[model samples]
Target chain A: MRHYEDIAVGERVELGSYTVTKAEIREFAEQYDPQPIHVDEAAARESVYGGLIASGWHTAAVCMRLLSEGFLNETASMGSPGLDELRWLAPVRPGDTLSASVEILDTRPSESREDRGYVKNRLVGRNQEGDDVISWEATNIIGRRP
Target chain B: MRHYEDIAVGERVELGSYTVTKAEIREFAEQYDPQPIHVDEAAARESVYGGLIASGWHTAAVCMRLLSEGFLNETASMGSPGLDELRWLAPVRPGDTLSASVEILDTRPSESREDRGYVKNRLVGRNQEGDDVISWEATNIIGRRP
Candidate 1:
């Protein structure tokens, strides 16, 4: 188990691989996005993206999956206040394998609270080709055990 | 039909409303996020957030829906180059009606090309209760009519 005490500033955590599937991307886009470039392959071929592409929101959602399966499973995580920045650096296509890394940037207890602390981390998601897909910083409130 | 040649700076586009639902939020959480606060209302009630809350990505997805159904539907848009910022200021719950507004900050055409241009815009989303739920800035490549 990863207690608040176990995490250090500048520490890096490598999240394992995640694959992007046409079915998954299509499902997500159909429900939330429904953009031609994201859901319809033939239309995507004629669109500006040049091919079917995963929605940027889908890319970020996959990154969140990595965060959960890799880091949150072992940590005493409360929840994040929110993200500060979210950038879709490049398009994600079906069949790409996504890997991620997180860096601890800052940690501090709430000024008014003793048992709860916050950790700021920079999360980066990359494709199998070593290209960045999404990058953002997340601020999470965690519980500190006495 | 709205052509890409017409979207000018300082223009404001009002996208329609999106209604949040517990089922949609839960399904999104199950597939990608699965955070306690996002997946289980009971667990969420015990958390610091004190109630069932949608995932931040879920909120962003709703904002995207508003953009697609209204703004994108009216414009000859290619695709975004990227997003500059995304701030999730508050939680969104079931039954929240999300409305969005886009401010075109700048527009620049490809100097060497005749068929494409870029637009920078600030997109803000508000919940039914009049709370700012999300704010983001993005750059998209728009198409020009022949």
Candidate 2:
């Protein structure tokens, strides 16, 4: 398994893409968000966005899926403390394909724990039209090589 | 509808609680996070957490549901730009009931737009034992009264 020692600062990895669907957007929104712009197409059209849009949380979850498939699955990931910041730069609409990527910004071995370290990365998702849809800086705990 | 003019800084609101289920935790993990500690009981038992736990995103989404039901539904919420910071303070496991709340921290009228303004709030979720499970600072766009 890829460990903390195996990764370095400045490394960038391309995560796979996901296409948002109208049905999935509505389903997720119905459960967690339920805002008019996310769940009701007609109301969304009358609102500021001018069309139905996916919930920001849904977009973040999609990016997490890509991160798991492309990077975290291969590593000895312990878990994450949380994110430093998150910005929904642009609206994610139905049928928009979002391609995601992560760039390692920094890595530091734990002072109190020898078995694990922290890896900081910047994650960004861009739509089919090349506009950034979401971005965040996250820190993950990765186990050291045994 | 409640508008930007209706809310005041330092206002605190209690969002309702939610009991997380094992099935729901695994479902969200399998779809998005899929981390072993979050999805597989056996694997999680061998991991540091020693048991299955909910994905951080799932916990955030649950909090979003409470926020929407308790507060956003009553206001002229346009949408959120995003959050400033998020920290998962403690692990969330199956059967854990989390109660959420939000306190308005600041508000600013948009310089370029008379139709809307920004509301900044601190959101927090505490488990049954009163331990904070997650917290974040988020900013939302709220429409002005017509």
What does the TM-score come to for chain B in model 2?
A: 0.99
RMSD of each: 2.1, 0.6
Which ten residues in a row are the worst by lDDT in model 2 chain A? A31-40
lDDT of 1 by residue, B21-42 (tens): 8888898888788888888888
TM-score of 1: 0.90
- Looking at candidate 1 chain B, the ten consecutive residues that score lowest on lDDT are B73-82
Report how closely model 2 matches the true complex, as a DockQ value.
0.87
Clashing pairs in 1: none
- Quality of candidate 1's docking, in CAPRI categories? medium
* TM-score versus the correct structure, for each prediction: 0.90, 0.99
Q: Which portions of model 1 show Cα errors greater than 4 Å?
A: A1-3, B1-4, B111-114
Candidate 2: where are CA atoms >4 Å away?
none
Write down the lDDT that model 2 would get.
0.96
| DockQ for each numbered candidate | 0.56, 0.87
